[model samples]
Target: MDMLFSLMSPQVFLLSCMVALLAGVIKGMVGFAMPMILISGLSSLISPELALAGLILPTVLTNGWQALRQGHAAAWGSVKRFRVFLLVGLVALLISAQLVRVIPHWVMLLLIGGPVSVFSIIQLLGWQFRLPERGHGWVEAGIGGFAGFLGGMSGVWGPPTVLYLTALDTAKTEQMRIQGVIYGLGAVALFGAHIGSGVVRAETLPFSVALLVPALAGTWLGFQIQDRIDQVAFKKATLLILLIAALNLVRRALIG
Candidate 1:
């Protein structure tokens, strides 16, 4: 508590609480929006690196629970299907951790946001797209590399992963479960990578814990509202949010 207070101003604390709450709700509902929401909201007040650090543990905990919630059968299935991708991505994330300080934040934002935005727009328009048939290993590896690097730098990996999953036409329940698993794996990898690289220091722990309460609260609220929303409306809302987040990333990159 004292450490949390020391690291954040009253206003920043309050704002972080609100953002966490909202992020939690989104996560509970969508199983994937928390990082995007939190990073997008917190980046204005905190350095991007700190914001990324603060989310590391909480995201790991939440997503680990989410991934395994559906029982071992489903979880294992997802793991088998995406194991190679996951392994490659995790390794890439570990490598990216080393470069966190060397790489400019804007460069990461541009790398992640530009392709993500373009892909999201293409997806929203109902275009039929597919990954290349040849060099499947290389293609998956490349996506994983980019996702892991950006995830380490910006704490946002969902765009690439989500796009791939969506393209696979995964069922809603399966999609959620897969997302949970991917996030869990990514979070665990991030914890090790960041800690090894000195990004997850003692000072960041208190703030991460402080943010958890609001995140849980928001998640509960989002669950309550999720069932009330229709599918079309949900997709539209999600797309809008993605576009806004992408724009925000682009703006941040350009300005900073």
Candidate 2:
């Protein structure tokens, strides 16, 4: 508790709690965006290094909750189905996390921003493509690598994973499960990777653990609200938020 509270000022600490709560609500509703929200929101108020560490524990714990929410059988099924993607993605995440400790902050922002903006715009513009069935395995590997690299560097890999799954025409139920499985394992990989990279050291780990409460609590609350939303409207709203966030990332990168 002392170590966690020592990581930030009272004002900044309250802001982080709000950020975690909002990010949790969005994730609970849409099944993605917690890291993006946390990293992006916190970056302004704190060093990105500390913010990166702060997101780790909550992300890992919450993703684990999501993966097992439907029970072991469903979770395992999704894992088996996307085994290639998970394997490639997690490996890439582990390797690339090492790079994060060396890279400049602005460069990381460009990486996160560039892909997010392009993808969000593409998704909103309704461009469509279908992969030849047999070649999709390789495509999945590629997507996983890209997602993992992004995940390692920016603490976000959702956009590419979502695009790949969306392109594969995965049904709604399976898509969520697939996302949960991918993110859960990636979170595990991230925890391990960062431990060695010093992103999960004692000072940072406490702050991360402290935020888990708001993150998880707000997620549960958001799940209750998810059932009340219209799918079409909610999707448009989500995209708008992504676009805004993506642009903000770019702006930050440029100004720095």
Candidate 3:
């Protein structure tokens, strides 16, 4: 207990717990957004690399649960279809992790936030856009590369994966499942990468473990609330959160 107390500052610990609570709730309701919520909130207190490392285990565990429970057979199909892209993306992430000490977080924020904002706006506006079928291999590779690179840097892998899944016109259940599986896989990759790169260290373990309690409690509460909310309303709330997250990234890039 004394050791754990020493690992985290009072304010930082409190804030981390609160963010974990909120992120857990959001993930419970929407089946995604853990990284976005946690990273955004934690950035105020911790370095971006530390924040990214902090999320690795919990996000993986949570999403692994969701993927197996909800995705089941459908998730396998997604894995099979996108295996090449996924592998390539993981490779990119591994390579980028080596550069954590050298690369600036602001560059990653701009890369991830800029595209996410533009894509989200276009999607929200209901624009009809389609990737060409003939060049899908190249497209997949490009997105996978970018996703891996940025994911390693900023812990924001959702936008590229989300965009790809959206373009595929995946059903709602499949969408959630695919996200869960991808996130779980990414978490595993990130764990290895970060550990090797020394981004996740013994000093951070206590804080990570402490934050999990609030995360679990919040997720349970969110699950209860999910049944009471309409789908449209839930979607709207998710969009709002996404907007806020994007704006926060931009602010961090430009001002911080």
* Per-candidate TM-score against the hidden true structure: 0.90, 0.92, 0.89
Candidate 1 lDDT tens digits, 166-245: 65655566777898898889988888888888878898877887887777677667656655776556555566666667
Candidate 2 local lDDT, 92-190, one digit each (tens): 998899999788878877877787788778878987555554557888899899999989987888777876766665655566667778887888888
Best-fitting candidate, measured by TM-score?
2
Q: After aligning candidate 1 to the native by TM-score, how far in Å is the CA of 113 from where it should be?
A: 1.0
Q: Determine the C-alpha RMSD for candidate 3 after optimal superposition of all C-alphas.
A: 2.3
Query: What C-alpha lDDT, on a 0 to 100 scale, does residue 118 get in candidate 3?
Result: 77
Candidate 2 — what's its lDDT?
Answer: 0.81
Model 2 ranges with Cα > 4 A deviation: 132-134
Per-residue C-alpha lDDT of model 3 across residues 1-256, encoded as one tens digit per residue: 5665675578777888889999989887766778888888888877676677777777877778767764467678768878867888899988888887888878877777777777767767777456654458988888888888877766678778877766766555566677778887887898888889887888766666777778778767866776577755655555566666777788888898
Clashing pairs in 2: none
lDDT of 3 at 122: 72
**Candidate 1 Cα deviation (angstroms), residue 13:** 0.8
